[model samples]
Target: MAFSSPELNFHKNIGFLAFLPLKTKTSISLISGKVVALEILYRMVYNSLTAFGGQHHERIRYEQSLADAKKAGLRKGLYLGISQAFVNISLYGAVALIFWYGPYLARIECWNYDAGVVMIIFTSCLFATNSISMFIPYIVAFIDAAVAGAKVFAVIDRKSPIDYTNHTNNQPHVVRGDIELRNVTFNYPARKEKKPVNYLLFSFYIIHLESL
Candidate 1:
């Protein structure tokens, strides 16, 4: 099957990418089921390299990862603390300003509003300010969601270098021929000291039949 154009194929691919997360989740569950066996093999490898202390490299990497995790945690905590502090300050400052100005307005008769009206406005402002603080706890979650969304969209938006749907060139639909290799020999460069493997000759002929 072939698409009408590259853009149509691209759209079809974008539709396919929508199911990528589900595919990834299934793959992750399958991998998780094999984690125990994989861990056993990993431990065996680590044990085999104990004589040369190759395992120490892994230990160092683990320690470094732990340290990075701690640093990230600390940074997140700092951001949360600063944001909460700012929110609290803003909330209290608004309350203080309203209380101080409400009485001053009444005393000076600057506005025609009474005590009841003042209280209503004050309560509304208080509720609105408090609502902002409620979102502080979810700041980190929002950041993580934004980052994940960027990664997903990045993969979807990326362009492939080769357009396989383009068949303008003289490409054969069905190839029929004999494949022959004559005196082909090769060996790994690392094993140059050893004897080279030789392939003296080989041939594979195609057998085509006409429709009866």
Candidate 2:
């Protein structure tokens, strides 16, 4: 349930952090599913509030999520919500009916029951369940946030299979709109890259070679 600063970031291959724990859905489901969702949402809002934040980026994220949702239409979430509500209402209604009618039915010959006792016992559970309902959404929210955070964190945690090997030179390299790739093979990452492009925007120095 506790993640140190470095544990939050698994990008670097650290040594002796054996206590860091291996990646598992257990903790994420147990803790993050309840609390980390809120953390993710709040962090998202905070990030958006930062100076260079842009709504367009968030919108893009949302749209992509929608697209993915559409693609993975196997799951029915709205249906699940409706079903949950109905089940809760039905269960509560049945309990209420039992407590209400149990007294009348008890008066029947040899039908012995304590309606008051049942009501008191169930009432406590009802109240407790109701109280828990208040936190359920927050838990789900945290779960959602954790998923979002995890996606980003997972991306950040990725490693480049193709190292900057075959550098061809030891000095810093630069690209000034002019370079050549003939029979020379280069495999660009269409997706799966750990660091953000912005990080690379200014990292290089200069290159005598130019790209057409």
Candidate 3:
């Protein structure tokens, strides 16, 4: 019902990201976060193309993404328009059929039809059609909500690879251990060309005594 500024900002950002292509969103997220830092290094934080590396490539990628999004939107719009049109035609056609058939049925002697019965049927049909038409416009909104809900539940139901539970073999009343690491060589994926860290070694002994 109500959201704080930070939460509102996050939702707004997520909404923006939802409209963009996945690759474009990922690239923008990855690069935009460091834009300030890069700019700061060059003594400019705003409107500095030099600090934003790979400008030409990024521009091309973003333009492609934009075009893709626009095309997708247009396609979906066409589908929605067609669906709405069909629904309107069917609904109004049903109404029109009742309008034409009700009076005809009232004139038939064998069917025992009357003016009151015809009017009731016509009014009921009209009311039902109006109600459905009022609700038809919301179908698209409902579909969007369902899609978003599915994505949220997918993330919620996913299992994490990391285990948070701790299973220590030490006795309940006493704990003692020595941990050691040696010859660890690694480098960040972003800076792999720099150098791999080597000669890293460390050891620590933990000892503790307590009541159960």
Candidate 4:
């Protein structure tokens, strides 16, 4: 679909020009009615290559921003690994303690050996099975999902400048006539603080021919 705004058209042109070779841009500049187009294209290329260096520079900056974040992630992973190791060691240690103490209590304290053994084993098994720390990954995933869902809801609840649903006040109707946009002042939203681009009246016109 064609854009009605000059800013949108300008951006679209820039994107299209980025993929073209230098030879193509030079050839297009030689064509008539392409002065404005070539000027915009040259500015886009200069800004992208020298000022920004396109995605290459942006990618490096993006990676640089994530350097600390990546280190933090590695640290978190290491901590979790250490925690898991401790949990495993504790589980094995509990089992060993049960085996070692059960016989001692039975022989010295005159306790029933089988009953002592059963109690230790059952208690250890219960504690190991019911521990919630084992589900750390699932809990982290749930928290992440909840945070993302809140962000999505915030965006969904926000009011937009153009509402497609409120069509009752401005109902669509057909007009049998030529439609024209004349003397329109246009400004790119990103560059709103800058001066608006003004075009003279009738400098640009759209001819809509109706059926006879």
Whole-model lDDT values for every prediction: 0.57, 0.43, 0.54, 0.49
The numbered model that scores best in TM-score is: 1
By lDDT rank, best first, the candidates go 1, 3, 4, 2
Ranking by TM-score, best first? 1, 3, 4, 2
Is candidate 1 or 2 superior in TM-score?
A: 1
TM-score of each: 0.55, 0.33, 0.52, 0.41
Write model 4 residue lDDT over 36-104, tens digit each, in one string.
Answer: 344346756765544654555544644554454455455545544654554455545555666567667
Candidate 2 similarity to native, TM-score: 0.33
Candidate 1 local Cα displacement, residue 37, angstroms:
14
Whole-model lDDT, candidate 2?
Answer: 0.43
Please list all clashing residue pairs in model 1, or write none if there are none: none
Most lDDT-accurate candidate: 1
- Per model, state how many residue pairs clash: 0, 8, 0, 0
| Model 1 C-alpha lDDT per residue in residues 109-206, reported as the tens digit of each score | 84786787779878987887676556555644545555458658998999886666878746667777767779888864323444465865776777
In candidate 1, position 79 carries an lDDT of 52
Give me the displacement of residue 190 in model 1, in angstroms.
Answer: 28
Predicted candidate 2 versus true structure: per-residue lDDT over 53-74, tens digit per residue: 6546655554553443443232
lDDT of 4: 0.49
Kindly give the stretch of ten consecutive residues in candidate 3 with the minimal lDDT sum.
Answer: 1-10
- Tens digits of per-residue lDDT, candidate 3, 1-212, equal 01122333343344334433433433334444354344344543355655667566555644554564455566555554654565566657766777677778877763777788877876776666556555444555655555557657998999876544645533356545666679877875334444457766776656634332
